[model samples]
Target: MKIVNFVGYSGSGKTTLIEKLIPIFCAQGLRVAAIKNAHHNFDMDKPGKDSYRYRRAGASQVIVRNADRWAMFSETPQGAPHLSELIAHLDPADLIVVEGFKSEDSDALRLEVFREIGRGEPPICQSDESICAVVSDKAREAFSALPVLDISSPEKVAAWITEKLQIKGIEKC
Candidate 1:
């Protein structure tokens, strides 16, 4: 399995890019999975629900079952694991796209959000060795020579990924 990552700050359109990319990858007839990292506490269980009640009762892990599906929610004090261990549950698919995890030193394609015209935050391209290319506002000035793509044009980004990774669909493989 191969791995690619998207990294940017909050409100940087990372999720939107991923949402668009998933379908492109899927249409390629290759299995694609994504891992999203959430820094804050979040609850998938509704309050007053049985599982929530059990968790409220101090259960470390709760498994709620039904005929169609089963989900296990566990609380760990150590926080999210590194990339390798977290993907154990995924289907042995073609590729895994990771969102967030900006600190990880693995190969990554960066996304830079240019909020205003002539705006200068040094662009994410100024630094960060892990960043391969940058997707940003459709302006060339905001980005250096490292390949600037339209942040809104996810198809182009998807195609670029395929070309960069030299990815042939699973059927082709």
Candidate 2:
């Protein structure tokens, strides 16, 4: 599957952009999957729930299912698995949009998101050679060497991604 990693500092609109792009891709009948990297501890199951109780009661993995959907929760006390290892567990798709894993070296295409209003941090594209393009809320002439996309225009970004991957249709199941 084709992969693209969107990296940015906190409050840079990475998640918002991804949310907008998913539907655009889906509307075109492409199978799209996303992996979001959480920086802190998080829980998907609530307290008193069976899956939560099972996990707390020493079950290494707990799966909760219903007619509509299912979710798998696994303990990773050893440490978080590498991005590639995590990707191995997912079903194949036409595109995989990764929201984090900015520091890890990988073959996935990288797009750096930058917003000038918040964080006031320098763009990662300055130092990260793996970045293929940048999406920003402001004009970034300094990054003239790379393709710069407008943050408000997710449709253009989605089109760029589809063209880059040469995606024509959904992958066969």
Candidate 3:
């Protein structure tokens, strides 16, 4: 499967852009999967719930399932797992969109999302060669060397991704 990463500072619209792109890709008959890296402690299970209780009871892994969906929660007290290891657990898909994990190196294509009003930090592309494009609300003077896309238009972004990956049968919307 092909992979792409969307990296940006907090509130830079990375997750919002991904949410918009998922349906567009799916509408084009492509199977899309996503992996989001939570930098802080997160809980999918609630206290007093069986899954949560199991985890509290020292279960290394707890799976909660219903008719509609299922989720497996695993503890990683040692450390976070590698990107490759996380990818291995997902079912096969046409593309995988990874959010965060900015420091991990891989062959996955990278798109740096930026909002002029969000943060003042330098762009990730300035220091990282893996970034192939920048999607932003306004043109960034520093990123003139790379392709810049309008943040309001997810279709254009999706089209560019398809073209870059040479994905077939997806006509530009």
Candidate 4:
């Protein structure tokens, strides 16, 4: 499966872009899967619930499924597994848009878009060579060797991703 990561500051519109692009990819008859990384503590199963109680007691992983939704809960007692290990659970898709995992070195094609003026350039991906493009709103000059994309059109961004991954987009007639 082809993996593309979108890296940027908090308000740099990563999620928004992904939201717009997902439908576009689906329209092209390509299966799309996305993974987002959150920094703070997150709780999928709410407190005071059966699953929550089980997890709180001492369960490493808990999965509860219903007619409508299927969810899994996992706590890393040892440590977090690497990206590829986690991604293995996902079904095969044409593309996987990863929101974070910037620190993890997976064979994902990285697209590091930045704000360029205020926040300055993002730290170079030192430990990983997965960065295939450095997209920016204005810092294109500094990263002269990388491909730059406008922050406006999700189509352009999606097109770039599809092109890079050798995935074809259905033409809109």
The candidate scoring highest on TM-score is 3
Worst 10 residues of 3 by lDDT: 164-173
**Candidate 4 per-residue C-alpha lDDT over 1-173 given as tens digits, one digit per residue, 9 for 90 to 100:** 89898876677677887898899898888888999988777788888999999999999889999999788988987877788887898989888989987777777889876664466645353334567775556544555566777767778888888888888755555
- Candidate 1 regions exceeding 4 Å error are 65-69, 107-121, 140-142, 170-173
Ten-residue region with minimum lDDT total, candidate 2: 164-173
lDDT of 1: 0.75
Tens-place lDDT digits, model 2, residues 99-143: 989989888989998887555677888888899999987777767
Q: Quote each prediction's TM-score.
A: 0.82, 0.94, 0.95, 0.87
> Better model by lDDT, 2 or 4?
2
* Residue pairs whose backbone atoms clash in candidate 1: none
On a 0 to 100 scale, what is the lDDT of residue 129 in model 2? 88
Instruction: Please give the lDDT score for candidate 4.
Output: 0.78
Best by lDDT: 3
25-141: candidate 3 lDDT, tens digit per residue: 988888899999999889988889999999999999988899999999999999999999999999999999999999999889899998765357898889998898999988878
- Taking every candidate in turn, the Cα RMSD to the unseen true structure, in Å, is 3.2, 2.5, 1.9, 2.4
